[model samples]
Target chain A: MLKKHNILVVEDELELAKSTLAYLTENGFSPFHAKDLKSARKLLKQENFSAVLLDLGLPDGDGMALIKEIKNAKNEIGLIIVSAKDALDKKIEGLELGADDYLTKPYFFPELNARLKSVIRRLNLEVNQEIILNEITLLPEQMRTLIHGEELELTAKEFGLLLYFVSNQNRVISKTTLGEFMSSNYADYGFTDDMVYTHIKNLKKKLSGSGCDDYIKNVYGVGYKFTVA
Target chain B: MKLLTKTSLNFISASVLFFLVGSMAMYFSVRNIMAEDLRNRLLQQQNEFIYTAQQNKVMDLVSELVFVQTTQNKQLYSFSDTVLITNEKYMLYRKLDFSYAQNEQDYKVSILLSQSESDKLIMKIAIMNIGFAMLFFLIMFFVNRHSIKSALGVFYSTIRKLEDFEVTQSSTLSLDTAEIEEVKKLNQVFEKMSAQIRKDFISQKEYTENVSHELQTPLAIISSKADELMQADNLSKEQMEQLALLLETTNRLSKINQALIFLTKIDNRFYTEGSTFSLNDLIKEKLSLFKDAIQDKNIKLKLDLLDITHVYMNPYLAETLIINLIKNAIFHNKSGGVLRITLSNNTLSIANSGGSLSFSEKDIFKRFTRSSENKKSLGIGLSIVQRICDLYSFNIAYSYADEHQFKINFKK
Candidate 1:
């Protein structure tokens, strides 16, 4: 069994901080909450966390400074900065200072989950992937995707998107979320929902053309759901 | 007021003085020249009179009698014991009326001359003085008027431009060529100053945008990692929910920052013009991009696009304006609401069904001004739209017709 990772969330807003703590616990991760840099630093000194989710604005000091201190301490902890300051310079500064990811406010919970998984994967979190679901064998690490014991050739975008859908199986994924996952430069690329339509269209066509039962179902006026039917 | 009045008074006084002095000098010189000529003629007349009387041989005693006579009236007097021989007396006698007749080269010369000629001489001197005074007055009037007209024109125009100047409107009151060199120089200075101010304004706007852009990546990392952490296994339900909310807030914060930075860029005029593109085509393309969002929100979009060819504008700015307008309509509108987008003759209008905006008509174009009711908005959307309109010289107007309506009239 893979040991669950621990995360430290530093946020000033009490309600928001509490909600984040709740969400982390429900998702099977232990989270330490801190309302300021001082408490966050104390938490850091006391226990080792797999990653730190730092908010840029803190009541005591800047969260950026905390990110720097963590990086400087030579701790192999992954950092993710949560800030209302979504300016390009702040983003670059946070990332340049060893933060693994950045997230803005008012984001969808599911998207946040997707981003969290990506970062964890980047950190090489140990997890068993050989799972048998009926006739399908899923091996996430080998990047081998199959249906009915036959390999399906999929584009890079298709593969990433499919994998994301598989991870969040049986849940409705919004097109906006799909676009975000498919695009590296989401803001600049103008990846609108139409682009999502085209990609999804291609993915569906390819899967069906490969003589595989279509698991991708469009939930009209919403998004798509990947499930074993 | 005092300074101007004094200077003008001095100028008038100096002109009057110059005229007076000049007329007086001319009058005196003319009088002296006339006196000398008259005296010389009278002396000659007196000598002729004596020579004629002597040659004709009147009584020797009588002929020898020296007489002094006034030339002005021809009154004679006998010098009982002395001869009248002084030039000064001859000059003084010429001042009186006198007459003399003599034959010179067969032409009888009758001369009646005085120190002052006829009354016409006085009138001529008066006329000459008056003419000179008038000439001086005209010169002064023209010079002063020219100086005043040029000065006041420049001053008033400068004030008008200052009053009417819009930051978006390039300074139209150019000092490139002025009638007065000094005014031209001043305008040049003003032009340089205004240019510098404009440059600084643009630079600061760009700096804000660039700074925001620089901040985006780190924010992405932080928010993404937080999100990832929220999804890991074996955590309490409360902790999981808390991480989830953190991730959501982070995402919204990141968007607001991005919007702010982009707004700054638009405000600073940091845009590039690409190839001429069809407004209709661009709008269609943008609408397609929002297809998912529109569908997801159940918003019905109706696009009334004209088959126009192209518009010469910064494509990026145009796109931004359109995107913001559409996005605003989408975000503020109720689910299943109607969104109408019309593009005709380069004019684009977007109307959407939504709650009444809490802002006044005036504040709609201002930056960071969200409706009082909606705190979640970054408030930079319409401001960005306004900026793009300004850059392209397009006309933008907003109206509230049960729903929010924004219209942009593009200029070629």
Candidate 2:
């Protein structure tokens, strides 16, 4: 069994903090919530967390301060900023201050989950060297993907989507979430739903063409889910 | 009418009227005085004749030029003026009729003297006054016109300066002095009002931006909490439906927030101008990106492309504009509908074979005009397209003739 990573969520709003904690728990992670920057730092000192979801605005201080604090720690903790839409500059600033990734407010839980996994992987990857999802296998450190002993001709966008979906198994993902993930990699204008659908189509076609059974299931009005069942 | 032209016209007419009325009054008074003097001189000639012929009996020196004898009893004298022919020229004659006892004899005397010279002098005065009046009119007209033109020059210079003032380039409007007082007042008022408008605009933009930023925290909470509630098991169908609706609403609210932020950024000049980009390439790329969606709807696209369609604009905005236009076209289209795109020099047009538009074409570019059955659209896409086109001074027009068409004429 995979060891569940612990995450610390720093948010001022009680409802948002509760929702985030609930989501983390549902996804099988041990989660802690702090309503302000002071408690967040205190929690960091008392126990170890795999990642810190930092909201930029807090009651006593800006969540932005936590990025620098986390960076200076002896064992570095992954920092993921959760900011409002207009805080584009602060997002960049936080990243420069040794934060690993950031998510805009109103972000989906699946999207957050995907980002958390990504950030934690970069900070400290899992001990298991290989990931197996039925016929497909992904070696994160090698950046190589294979299916049924055949090499995949995957574009950079396709490979990134495959990796995120594989890592976040059984999670429903919206078009906005996928587009944002792709744009983060390319640093281009965030894509539209149509583009996301196109990439997903290409990804599904390539995977299925390689003698793999159907894995990506559309959730009708909700979004698409990547699950074997 | 221009102020100068109007005032100059009024001035010319007023001066001309004054000169005419003045000259006419002078002419009548001078003529009346001249006629009275002629009558007085004629009466004096009659008295001198009586003194010479009757009192001194100096009949040898009496001249017969203006004298006539008449036999009439108790005659009284009367004087009148008449015109006479003298050397084929019209002359004035003042005639006097009298019966007087001269040398103790009853004689009726009729005397005449020429008043033609005084009449000619009056005529000359009338001619001089008319000529002088015309000269005065001409001089005053030119003076009035020159002063008006110079005053108008000041007005136009101030107006031209005002016209040249762009809000982005200049913080304050400066005006040259105006000789016209009313124009000066106009300038002062405009300067004050424009400055206030600029100030108010900045404040309003700042407030909107701040509100938009502040809404994000609460909105995120609402959305995430709603999503969490949706994942709970054993929920009724009604609960699930309500949650789904709530999520959709939250997503729309978020889109509106983003749209407003985009507006504030554009207004704040966050995107700097100038970059050469291939518009053709962007359009083609966006079309390809939408291929899957279009295929899902079974839509066919007809393309007419030029060899090159390069344009000068911010590349990011250009891409966004194209994407919005294509997205709007695909989203509103009918299944198996035909989408036609034409790209040429400085022009690009998109036509989609959708049924009649739900709203008027004029309202299509306005914010929040949802003209289709698609619930996923926020109705802000076309307005954003219009705004981006407006920022670049590109003329975009929408029309529906068997198919809905949006055409943009780029400024080269």
Compare the candidates by TM-score and give the number of the best one: 2
Find the number of clashing residue pairs for candidate 1: 82
Best of the candidates, DockQ? 2
lDDT of 1 by residue, A10-62 (tens): 98777667667776775667899988989998998998888888888777877
Query: C-alpha displacement of B399 in model 2, angstroms?
Result: 4.0
Chain B only, TM-score of each candidate: 0.56, 0.72
TM-score of 2: 0.69
Give lDDT tens digits, candidate 2, residues B200-311: 7678766776676588778888878776775554657577667766766776688788886886667665566669878888888878777656777788989888757788
Number of clashing residue pairs in every model?
A: 82, 0
Candidate 2 shows a clash count of 0
Clashing pairs in model 2, backbone N/Cα/C closer than 3 A = none
Residue-by-residue lDDT tens digits, candidate 1, B193-236: 87877787767875784465456545545554565564444646
lDDT of each: 0.67, 0.77
Query: Candidate 2 lDDT, tens digit per residue, A1-229?
Result: 7888889999888888888898899888899999988898899999888999988878897777778878788345788888875545677798898889888877777778877886777778563467788789887666677899788788777888888888667765655556656655654342456677888899999988888778887655445667766
| TM-score for each predicted model, relative to the true structure | 0.49, 0.69
- Stretches off by above 4 angstroms in model 1 are A125-144, A147-150, A169-229, B1-97, B100-265, B268-386, B389-412
